[model samples]
Target: MIHHHPDSNMMLEYASGSLNWAHSLVVSAHIQLCPKCAAQMKLLNGIGGTLLAASEPVTAAPTPADSFERLMARIEEDTDASPAAQQVGERQTTAARTRSRKAKRDPIFASVPPVVEKLLSTNPVLPWRRLSKGLKEARLTTGQNRHEVAFHRIAPGSKVAEHDHRGKEITMVLYGSFSDAEGVYSTGDFLVREPGEVHRPTATQNQECLCLSVVEAPVALTGFWGKLINPFLSIRPS
Candidate 1:
């Protein structure tokens, strides 16, 4: 069960399509795993749809005949009407199903939602890079500014470097569990760390922990050793 979740305001922004793509992706993955958040998202979407329907539509100018014709022609061309296109679609679907089955067999990806699984499947053979002795990281490029999305894998009984956020940081536990000064978080927990919040997260002894993290700005490590490595630890926008 998920004890932590994105606040109501964040969920409302997600429902209204106001959040940046990276943040939205994290929230979407969480909603898929958390029934409470999923229900809340549905309620927010309903409210948004109602508000949109009740609002007056603004008058708009008509497009030129040539432009309208070109748009219609493009739409028609995109339709899958040919036998060859149907064959290609079938092959792609089969390949996707094969990948899905393989993912289910892998322990690391067994609990991941379809949203995150699709992203992970894009680079199935890529290896996780070592960030420290017991911590590894894999970056998920979303082509977004400021926000750095990645998977942080912590080995059993290992602690991440102590750090304070410069901006917002949202972390969703994808596997195992971890604890910090604030609290202990298990799978499906959504943790939001605002600016100036400092804590060191350590995975439990029994299993390794994997978390999906989205950071708006690079974190600043605290303490003497952390300060020494702070420059190299800064996670820049990709």
Candidate 2:
């Protein structure tokens, strides 16, 4: 049975596309694994659409002067530019925006299935990243890695060294359980460690543990050896 869940309140926020992207990713992973939340989400969507249909549409905003002309000119210019220039221009404009949009949409949980959102809300701490022995971490989302995601796998009896998150941290267990000095967490459990909090997590030998997690920025390790591995392990936003 699922132990933790995000209630209707949080679920609604997610369904309405209000939650953060990193948070939404955790929810997405959860929906992939859970079923109950999926049903709930469907209900929420129906309710939302009904509400929308019941309301009158708002007036459309007026187009700016020369907007259409400018758009046409830009299209013509794009067609005339050399391939190299077009590629560079595409990277500077379309590519950048596409990535930005995806990253922005990453946390909008409303689009995700219902069951996953509930499981994500199960543990509401930020999320944790494992840096090294006896050390774990929490990441915060500022403005990087718009689409990429990452997670950690801790062997039973294993711990990570100290570190700080560059962005939000959301973790959900795939198997087994783990605990820190704070409390014990088992399979199907979720943890969201907020930014700035630091703690080391250890898993029990009962079974191997898998966690689904996502972050918005890179993580910074504190120790000397850990810092050396930072570049290799550092996660950039998608």
Candidate 3:
């Protein structure tokens, strides 16, 4: 069973198509992996449609075409879509949201969710960039300037250096389990860290840990090497 998940507000935003693409990808992957979250998404989608149907639309003189098109597009979704089919399409909208053109920029490159594989494939093949002894990252150019997104893999029994966030950081485990000072997160777990929050995460000795991360800003690593690296750690351009 999954132990952590995005909050209700985050789920609502994702359901309503208002969430940013970067974070939405994390949530999208989580929903695909967790049946419980996927079910919640269906519920939220229904509630959103009902509320939207009952509410009045803004008829401002300069109503944006894209906004109006989105509203009409959502309103046009077949009310009778099958549960099985809807389940399959859960991540499709997310894939669409991430469709913007980027200005720039495995084994665990295998076995990830299809959406993840699809998005990462759009960029050139990149060698896994080692961040520390046991931690390696594969970056993704998700069109946002502030959010730096990537997949991180930790070798079994390895510990990521302790660190605090400069801005918000959200992590979703895709495989195996890892424990932080807060708790142990397993597959499908969603974690969020706010500015100044600190923790050290260690991959369980039993298996390698792989995760997807979306950071609003770079992290402020906590020790000697971390401090040395912090000044140079800036969000990469999308």
- Native-structure RMSD, model 2: 13.2
Cα-based TM-score, every candidate: 0.81, 0.54, 0.77
The best-first sequence of candidates by TM-score reads 1, 3, 2
lDDT of each: 0.79, 0.57, 0.76
Q: After superposition, how far is residue 32 of candidate 2 from its true place, in Å?
A: 4.0
lDDT of 3: 0.76
lDDT of 3 at 215: 87
The clash number for model 3 is: 2
- Give the least accurate 10-residue stretch of model 1, judged by summed lDDT: 63-72
User: Which candidate has the top score in TM-score?
Assistant: 1
Which candidate should be chosen as best, given lDDT against the real structure?
1
Write down the TM-score for model 2. 0.54
Model 3 lDDT at residue 125: 69
Error of 3 at 193 (Å): 0.8
Candidate 1 per-residue C-alpha lDDT over 50-120 given as tens digits, one digit per residue, 9 for 90 to 100:
99899999875543323323433443444323455568777677667756667655587676876676666
Give the clash total for candidate 2: 34
- Tens digits of per-residue lDDT, candidate 2, 63-128, equal 321332343344445333445666776656765653454465324223333333333333235477
